[model samples]
Target: MERSVIHNLIAALPVAVVAVDHEARVSAANVAASALLGENLTDRPFVTVLRHPVVVQAVDAVLDPAHVSLPVPDPTLAAVGSGGYRNRVIISARGRDIPAEVTVSALPDRIGALVVIEDSSGIEEAEQQRRDFVANVSHELRTPLTAMIGFIETLRGPARDDAAARDRFLSIMETEAARMNRLVMDLLSLSRVESEERRRPAEAVDLTMIIGAVVATLTPHAEAHNVNISLIGAENEALVTGDPDQLTQVFHNLVENAVKYGGSGGEVRLELSRIRHEPALRGPAIAVAVIDRGEGIDEMHLPRLTERFYRVDNHRSRQQGGTGLGLAIVKHIIGRHRGRLRIESVKGQGSRFTVILPAKRDRR
Candidate 1:
């Protein structure tokens, strides 16, 4: 094949490809390479252009010939031969950092070597999520284990002679066990929401009914805290298409959070509104807002609140019996429903959590 044809063909390939000479100067680069390393990459040292330590190492290994001559086989060279390099390295171009997975190989013509680059940001994100998941699970389990150990020790030693003390310890142990059970159930629900393969069609759902049920169930807690819980706006039949259980869980978490964290004498308000009208008259999207008059979240911590196991105030949250997974679960549930979840707060003022569910389509 002609050189131009070969160049075009290589350039057309999806993966970023670059070729360098024995001196490590870029002799040719494909379209992907041009786009990534810049169009004027020729004559630039592959290392200087790509600027990724791992890519540079692989290129240096292939060009040095010493790597091939070494008595002990180098894994990097073997990876080059197999055409599968999964090295994690940072690439900087124009002062911006880029994460990449690089594959390097010795060219047949000895025209230097071929380096293929693939963006690995998504993969790294997945790995980070996995790590967070494991850590959260361990932490959640540790709480129950610690309580169990403390209670068992009291029953076996200090509380053995006192019947009332032993009973109290046993009750506390039971409560801890129940908390662990709830944690497990929430984790399973979160996993299901995250990994659900089938998308269920949405239907008209009454937001008022869901909110009312949640409020009724949590009213005692609100009273116990001396906080007033009230629903705002007219009780209109607002409807949205989405999973009922998930939506219920979303409201339950939001209201429960307000009741738990809002100051002892503060008020919790749940409001509903519609936005942007349509022909089907599904009504404005059913928006439910949970407002709490409590210590609000800081602006800086807003973005990461939905991250799994994230807590704005770990000690306060734990004291209020929060699982730390509540917001994360609420976010995912809203996403599955094709809705938006937002948190607006001002420190020392209060926090408002809004869930906007798409209006149900009128099948008339």
Candidate 2:
């Protein structure tokens, strides 16, 4: 191919590519390569442009006269021959170290070598998340598992002859087991929600009805704790496209949380309205706010409320049987519905959790 054509093809590649001559001087560098390694790489030694010792050594091996005389390996292959050639390295870019997969291939006609750099940032992030998730899950499960095992041993030995002690230990054991069960269920639910987040729900749902049902279902629990649950605003039907089951879970979790934590304030309100020109929603939307009158959350904790296993008061959260995945699940469900979830709270005053869904366009 013509030199210009080759350069154009290299420029179009998503990964960074740089071509070097027999002396390891850069002959052509694509746009990605320039952005990563800095511009003005033409005629610059590969060692200076790449900086990484492993990459420079690979380039040297590819340009070696002994290998150049032999038939050049296929350029289509991802990496050069596997003679302990380092194919991965960290490079500094835009003031940050970026992990990249470097592949060196011998150029046809034995002119030089081609260096391909593939950014591995996404892969690294995913791997880190997997590790963190496993660690968090293990820690969460271990606490309850330890308690259950201790109680079992007591019931088998020390508490065996004491009926009252055995009963109490059994009750404690049951609660611990239930907590573990809830945690596993929440984890599974979160996994499912994340997997389906990219697919928009096609079914039309009534926002008002879902809210009313959630309120009615939780009213008794609220009453038991002296909290009055009420649905206010938007008496008319508010329609939107979403998954009804998931929406129900979203409202249920929010209201349950309010009753659990805000019941001391004596009132939990569900407000609905239709609004246009909201900045976050960016269009017409049906807004549902789950407002509580209890002691509100701190400003610092608000941002991380949707994070998995995050809690403001860990002891209180555990006592309340919270899995710490409620808000995370709600956040994902709203996102899947092409909506937004916003939290506004004033310490010692109250907090409001709002869900905004795009309003269904009128077909008539």
Candidate 3:
């Protein structure tokens, strides 16, 4: 009933709230309202402070006795009846346009109308991310599915008359099916990694030993490509608290990528070094870098390497049987361990992929 009491009630609200008198002037505005709309909002004409036509109309409809003219039918305004007016609209704040929900309700005793504005930017962004992720997954699966379907039809019809043609088609079909399988596996892995990314792994493990085994396993593949994988700092021990399986996966993907992309240079080197103080990690750390001598990546493509499904050469990546989720997985795995992935490359000198993790304080 009292003017000061009404101001206190509006100010106590968590979200942005503005009250307009029957005369259409801003009678009271909370701190959040000033932060959203602008400073010095009190005593100003509500229409002048909130220039949006739809919002102004909504407020006016609640204060109808003031003789304020209502604009054309606005879809943004959900209701403008006796009880209240509700709206979802975009408002500009600090130079960026954001989704805002505004609801105007008439106050009892004709004190004024209360206007509430809520920012929905985060919800909108998260929803958009979900939609984009679904679209990407659908497209990735469909390409291999389409190819497999075509090959199956040929095998069932034209290729049925010839043994050689059938064998070739079946091989192509098998490859497509395998690609789909890898995509599915990678999707699941990415999901698991993301869900547990916030929890840091605490098991102590040896980086050198893990990389040594990875190198041994991938040696034959390197030999087939005539690329030598020389492991440096293998004799020295560097320990860290981490999930061995995830750490292994991180190195496996990095080393395999080097052997696949930079193997043309005839050498893929796994170099390990100690960082006394990794500024990013803010303490002592261990760094393992996978260096290649083949043609390097362009500077422009470096920044987005960890983004899910981002590929510098999509066709070549597919040919190499890459899921395009390797680096993304690597990024999250390292994050869970409170580490960092550094990528450095030159157009002609090849690229270096480094994994730096916090070192275990005491070695067993």
Candidate 4:
């Protein structure tokens, strides 16, 4: 077939495609293929562009019927049809080894082979993340369950005759049980937030009131930790399009976190204000900042603070009854409101978590 005809044919494809002529040289390549494989793909040696042995053999078989490795029928080829040979191979593209599924098919009359490459990077990454999430949940649940089981066996055996030991064991068991319960609850909340993340909240909720209520609710906990939780700039009503319950949860998590981890400075403050033109929110907005005067977080940890189940200090988080999903849930809630969360911190200057929400909902 003519190189121009081959070019026109494969150019219509949305995926990456490279065509090799009877001489085993690249005859044509689509835009997508050039972008994936790199520049100047046309007329380059196919082996130089993609040096994988399996891919070279597949092209060889398609180009020359008498080649040792002729096409063999694969049950998996039911999707691609009997005319095509498919293989998953890693191809070096722009200095990076990229995972891809390449399908090689012979052109009519032994003209050449048409190779289609499908990038599988995204699919593989998502699968890995799913596996990690399952493993993390299993570990979180197993730790407390195992502790509680050991404690139960002890109380039923040697500790049965000792009242003091029984009381202590029971208390420890209670704490472990609560930990398990909190993990389950946080998982449920995370799931719920993710589910509703695309749905914009329509209710005009009072942000000022919500912050006040959260401050009131966590004041006792703050006092117990020798921390003072205060709400500032809440004298006037601040309304935004959001779910009241979710907003309440967002502030509750932030305030509780400030008290638990940043309470060393003895002061956690919530600062609320109105922004006339917030760049991120695209208009006038309301920003509620949860600030802590305690020892600040490292700059490195700020970027990943909203990642699910990620904690700066695992031991400290567990001891403080943190499930590590609090910030994740807060992020989703703010997203559903078409807002953004900003984290600012220095090694010793404390941290500021600012939640910015657009004052008006987009009706367009």
- Per-candidate local distance difference test: 0.77, 0.86, 0.88, 0.87
Best by lDDT: 3
Clashing pairs in 1: 203-241
- Candidate 3 lDDT over 98-142, as tens digits, reads 898989889886668998999999999999989988888898899
- lDDT digits (tens) for residues 1-364 of candidate 4: 7878989999999999999988889999999998898889888889988888778877887777564454356333322444558887777888888888999988878788899999999998899989988988998989888988998899889888999999998898899889889989989999998999999888889898889889888898889989988788999988898899999999899889888888998999999999999987678999999999878899889889998789999999999988888899999988888889999988777789999998864579
> All candidates' TM-scores?
0.82, 0.90, 0.85, 0.90
Residue 359 displacement (Å), model 3: 2.8
**Model 4, residue 94: what's the lDDT?**
80
Candidate 2 ranges beyond 4 A from true positions = 65-86, 278-282
In model 2, the worst 10-residue window by lDDT is 68-77
**Model 1 off-target regions past 4 Å?**
1-14, 19-36, 51-75, 80-99, 106-113, 197-200, 263-265, 277-284
Candidate 2 or 1, higher lDDT: 2
lDDT against true structure, model 2: 0.86
Candidate 2 lDDT, 245-300, residue by residue in tens: 99999999999998898777899999898997667768789989989989999999
Off by over 4 Å in 3: 1-44, 62-74, 78-85, 105-114, 362-364
* Candidate 3 lDDT score relative to the true structure: 0.88
Cα-based RMSD of the predictions, in order? Answer: 4.0, 3.8, 3.4, 2.8
Candidates sorted by lDDT, best first: 3, 4, 2, 1
Instruction: Give candidate 2's TM-score.
Output: 0.90
